[model samples]
Target: MIDKKTYNEIGVHIPSILLPKEGIDMQKWSVVACDQYTSEPEYWEEVEKKVGDNPSTLHLIFPEIYLEHGNADERIKRINNEMKRYINEGILVSQKPCMLLVDRSTPHTKSRKGLILAVDLEKYDYSAGSQTLIRATEGTVIERLPPRVKIRENAILELPHVMLLIDDPDKTVIEPLAGKLDSFEKVYDFELMMNGGHIRGYRIDDGETLKGILKAIEALADPEVFKSKYKVGDDKGVLLFAVGDGNHSLASAKVHWENVKKSLSEAEVEDHPARFALVEVVNVHDDGIVFEPIHRVLFNIEPESVLNALQDFFGSSCCSLEKFDSLESVNKRLSELKREEAVHSFGFVTDRSFGVFTVQNLKHNLEVATLQGFLDYYLGKQKEAKVDYIHGEDVVTKLGSKPGNIGFYLPSMEKHDLFKTVILDGVLPRKTFSMGEAEEKRFYLECRKIVKD
Candidate 1:
């Protein structure tokens, strides 16, 4: 048996990872994360056409776009049924007690290295001002979590798209393994559908390497080392793992684990599969880890009403708005802003026009937080308005320019700022950053049985 103490100390576990058996078409079986391309139904439609009637991850996961179409209970029911069918029919087979070393090459970058891991939820906390081993980099939208929590509560096998990030400046953990990949067993290699990317998986099942990886990760969490690295006081919590890609997904897993623990004995809880969430852990220093701004588009609200509300909510005296003839002008203006000039600047688009809003004397470390503060306050006052975090400038612009809609194009934070920022600041405003564009997001390829026998 593997030492649970070693795993617990490092907040990591070796999963009996699952994949489709031989003779199955791996291409159709893999799908991009459900959260991507929310406004583009045509993207999912194309995916459906490619995966028709096959035993695919598409069958097990419910895409968010389908949630608004109504009969969500029916969709959830169908999803549960498909999971059981796949498991019982032997579609997903496991290579016992292993971690997957992944080499993913997307169109945007050459290669991103990741290790598939099962992280202990007990060490994770998403609440504001967390000091746990695992922390959230951005604020989580609690209202956006219920539907996801419901899906996970009944999920049999979890196909992970969530990614955890480590700030290893010395390249201690993942970088050293890249040169030695040939010694490992190659498991899966294929191109992702819909121009997503190409991925190759290799198995890491030996006890020697697993022990070394655990030790390296544990060293990163050393309180003294962490304090010196970030120049933080000893009173702060150690933040070894930060949710990089799927913030809410890990939050949902933590929620479901909390709920599950209530019904179990303390001993039973220790060994349950649901206590750990499957994730891909990548080094923040990875060459392919591009930090992109997650844009926002609010629907069913008058664009003028939103601007008026923003002006009123932040107080008319503190901020100023400048109008532009087109989005190009707004972009050019925002790019021209000096570091000292902009407390923060947001470029916006509406059905009528495009402009940039500059706010000074900020209340938060990030502009997203300042904007989200106003949005939450504004949405509470009106029942008809709703917001969605969008990927890509074109999608946000197109959606924002539609009638009765508005989109705010936020700026991307520096990639190097992530670990230190989250260290000193509790968490940034929700929907603060995205790992890459929608097409470059992690695709679902491997599965681990989340249900205990």
Candidate 2:
């Protein structure tokens, strides 16, 4: 409900929990975004133990682990209460109108630096083939929007762990603002607890630097140049921003705003804060950003069952090899398989040992694009094919080695071809390339109120 003029003029005056320059004990002060590690409860448990009673960000935010619990409603109530408490108690302070400069370092030795500012929702759109100012790099999942809507509905404040990506590999937008850092005041600088690494922030009050960023964004948004950059036709609109992560969160905002718009007029509709979602936009070409492959683990299915499934999916040409006893052997075999050969491999595991299965001539809709869709179609018919998307090969091996489980490893998406592929062809399949691994994920820190006055 926030308009561009007001959004740019006053911006959203949301409060944030500021860390002192003396340096925060980051291990306790910084926590992973609530949505990460949803399938891994142990990680969250460790975080809880590490952040115990430390006035941590953990207390201020709700972990998605509690999403299914009975106390979820109560926890959300507490979150809203805490937002008011943090503001009323002066635990969070307000800054003069400006963009917040942030430097984030992950546990994986990668660092991302950017500015936190409110983007006008009016300029954003998420429809397919949308030339809207904002777009999704991968297809947005419509099914995941409801729970997020419920989470943000009554909240007094919204905290973002979402990172948006722009193709500014030349360090054009964010780097120039660093020179003016001395002109702005320092807001937060601390170490994130539990190996999240370090984070620092400065508030930019100078109109000149902010205007420069606006100009850069304007250039990227320019219709002709934008189309040429993507090599699309002149009639096509420019798709400048992409939802690198937190697609659901942004979709939830869109859903909530559409629902709220029924009773309000055009003018009144622009006043609500729910219109804009908070996100950190990083350059896709930023050296710190890496695209990792998301591997799959099928749980509670026996090794023989996996073999049988593969054989059934690929027909009589499928073959099983029990000699692939080591992880390296399986990797070497899988890497050598050609995409055009219609052959695929899987690592099967049981409580006692691990083995491998190689399938050939699997009937797939589009060999490269619909791997998950085909799996979903086949798995939907079977009772034991429970799949989990995982981040690292180590996790894949560990999970697949568990009782009644198997793992399928996929190749990583080529980063250079992502935008072109999406522009030429439609969006890629969901659960595609991960921006970074689990710990390197965007953390919840900056916030913007979607409701406007």
Candidate 3:
């Protein structure tokens, strides 16, 4: 067990990770994050066929795609039952208290490395302008939490796809651990399903090694170090960790913890399982990590009217629209803008035509911020209009080309600016950037009990 002193020092707890017993098909057992493939039900259907009664994380998670399909209450009931059965039937066995060193490889990215550990929720604050050591990189949508809270509130086990980022530009924290992995025991090594690339985990159980990791993380959180790195004033709060992905999931955990803590005694609050959430923390400077933009696709809207509304809102002086004959020309223009160092320009594709919209004067720093603001207002006025945040240019072309559909492709934000921007300007707009494509997301492999026996 992790003592209070150690937990306080590192803002992490070594969890008793639950893994499937031997002879289980690890390939079928792991699945991508629940939040991914929300627009495509067929992806989940394919996953169902592959798992086929085998013990899998698919049974434990309620995919968002199915959230609106009805029977949500029944689905959550089945999830909780599966968790209990997994424990009772010895399908999942707990290991010694340790951190899991993860190595992930995908087709589009280099081998990304991370350490899976439980972070103290107390150190994290998702509210705007929070001064905590852990902060959200993007704004948290409270309305999106009820469905997630329902799934997590009564669950016996928690499997996290939440990825946290630490800005250790000098590579002090997670990088050094990779060198000493020879001493750690191997956990699970297998290829993930759904074209999600390979993954391997090692257990770090040595007390001294765990302490070393904590010390490194603490150094990154040091006030002077943070100030020097970001060139900020002494009054600025040190942001040691940032939410890289799954901001909503982490927020839900926080909300549930708040509700749970209210009913617990002071003693229970000290080491309550609900007080910490399991996450894989990765270094921001890791070469394997790539920041991709989450583009916007609008459905059931008059494309011409939407374009005119954008011009009306921003005015002709600030907003200019240039039409293109095909997707190639639009992409070519966007590629040129990248070399020209132009910002606040977005490419749009529709059934009628393709074009690029350039805004000379902007209220927000990122193009997505400016575009999303207008969309929120426009969609509010048009009750029939709907928008989905999507990844991949190909998806935008395919879906946005359908009649009455339009997609706006926004450029990605620089990885280096993420920490400093959040520290100075508060949280960014939601759905700002994706860490990688959907397939590259963290798959559920490890589990921990959140409810006390």
- For model 3 the local lDDT of residue 201 reads 95
lDDT for predicted candidate 1 compared with the true structure = 0.89
TM-score of 2: 0.86
- Candidate No. with top lDDT: 3
**lDDT tens digits, residue span 186-270, model 1:** 9999998999889999898888888878888889988899999999997888889999988889999999999999999989998
Which candidate wins on TM-score? 3
TM-score of each: 0.96, 0.86, 0.97
Instruction: Please give the TM-score that candidate 1 achieves against the real structure.
Output: 0.96
Ranking by TM-score: 3, 1, 2
Q: Is candidate 2 or candidate 3 better by TM-score?
A: 3
Write candidate 2's Cα lDDT for 208-248 as tens digits. 66666766766666677767677788766566677777766
Q: Which ten residues in a row have the lowest lDDT in candidate 3?
A: 1-10
Winner on lDDT (2 vs 3): 3
